[model samples]
Target: MEVSRIRYWLGVLLVFLAAFCFALKGVLIKLAYQYQIDALSLLTLRLLFALPFYIGIAVYQRKREPVAPLTLREWLWLFFLGITGYYLASYFNFIGLVYISASLERILLFTYPTFVLMMNAVSRKRGISRLQWGALALTYLGILIAFAPHIQFGNQHNVLLGAFWVILSGLVYAVYLVGSDSMIARVGSQRFTCYALIAATIPVFIHYLIRNGFALLNYPAPVYGLTTIMAVFVTVVPTFMIAEGIKRIGSANASLVASIGPVFTIVLASGLLGEKITALQLLGTAFVLAGVSLIGWKGKKM
Candidate 1:
């Protein structure tokens, strides 16, 4: 019992740290943008810096466990997931952040869980439960409320464009999550993540080469520094932390703990990026948290 208690608390701590680190992602991206680097270039640099770590993990895991080679079909699935989840989804998200405030970007991205539920319902050919319907309603309502201020005060067109891209990012990421379920069950999560990321790195580099061809590497030294931090701290570290946290506590509790991410992003944006925090945004955030929490609780019960 004592050991179990310690594990649970440690899981909570890992999840909290992961959430906090993820909250810094938007701010870091926003800061990197200040250096006038294009989204693709910054993304490429991040992946470049991150690639070695993931490769090392993959190699280490394979040697440690000595699993049989994956089938061709599994390789295809990994490629598909890597493209949709890491490459395209992240591309859209980085593009969206080019226009919107980090606070809004984080809030909008947080709605992906709703997309996951919707996709699950469709795929299963079952109607959403009343509780889930209410959860969905609350989630969209929160988005609208949070979005109103930007529409009123900011460049209406830019805000709309950014929100659209972010929403698309969320949708694609939801597809990735849904597809990953069976694959993760088959291949262990750590190996799956490492392999998927490795696959994703291929396309990222290809895209960078086609688009910029080394021309965009001429940025201030701080730009490289920021991307390195974003790669190691925000992207890679939190990922494994969340996975380990889930192993200890379970996905439901880890998700609940992760609800702190948007709130932390809001506070960080205010402090670092000078983004304002208004009552409506906070209210919207509360509603989103409640709705997502409802989903997590319902998912746990089911």
Candidate 2:
């Protein structure tokens, strides 16, 4: 019992830390844009830096545990997951961040859980509980609180466009997560992530080559430096950490622990990007957090 408790708490810590690192995604992308790199170019650089590490993971997995080769169907599924979850989702997010505040982007992207819940209900052909429905209400209410002030004060069109992209990002990512349940079960989490990321890296490289071609070499030192930080710290490390966290704690608890992500992004955006923390944003943050808390608590009860 004591050992189990230790493992559970350790999993919680891992997931919380993962969420913290993941929270930096919006801020890092925002900072990277200051170098004048377009979304695809920066994304290419990020994937370029991350690819080697993912390859290393693949090699390590192969050596550590010799497994049967993936079937064609399995490979296809993984490829699809990689594209939807990482490549396209990331592309949309980077583009979206170019227009929106990092805080808002984070909040919008964090709605994946809600999407996942709805998807699960649809797939299972079951109705959501009153508690869940209420939680969803709270979450969206919080989103409105956070979103209204910025869109009201800023360029409404730009903010709305950005919000649309980020919402798509969250929806696609939620679909990826829903698909990942079986994939992660079929292959180990680490193996699945490594392979999926490898697959995702290809499209990123291809997209960059088509758009920028040799322009990648012309980037200044600061751009490279920032891309390196994003690739290793924000991309690779947190990606694996979250995967391991999910494996250890299960998705529900892991997501609950990750509810702190928006708060981190909001605080970081204020400090690092010089973004303001308005009253509405604060109130919205509270609502979102409360809604997420209610969902997690209600889930535990069920």
| Tens-digit lDDT string for candidate 1 (1-302) | 99999999999999999999999988999999998898899888888888899999989988898777889998999999998998999999999999999999999998899999989888988688999999989988988899899989874458899999999999999999999998888878888888888899899999998988877568999999999999999989998999999999999999899988999999999999999999999999988888988888888877
The TM-score obtained by model 1 is 0.98
Candidate 2 lDDT by residue in tens digits, 6-119: 888888888888888888878888887887889899888888899899999889989999887889998999999999988998899888998899998988886777898899
Model 1 clash pairs are: none
User: Which residue pairs in candidate 2 collide?
Assistant: none
> All candidates' TM-scores?
0.98, 0.95
Q: Give RMSD (Å) of candidate 1 vs. truth.
A: 1.1
Top TM-score model = 1
lDDT of each: 0.91, 0.86
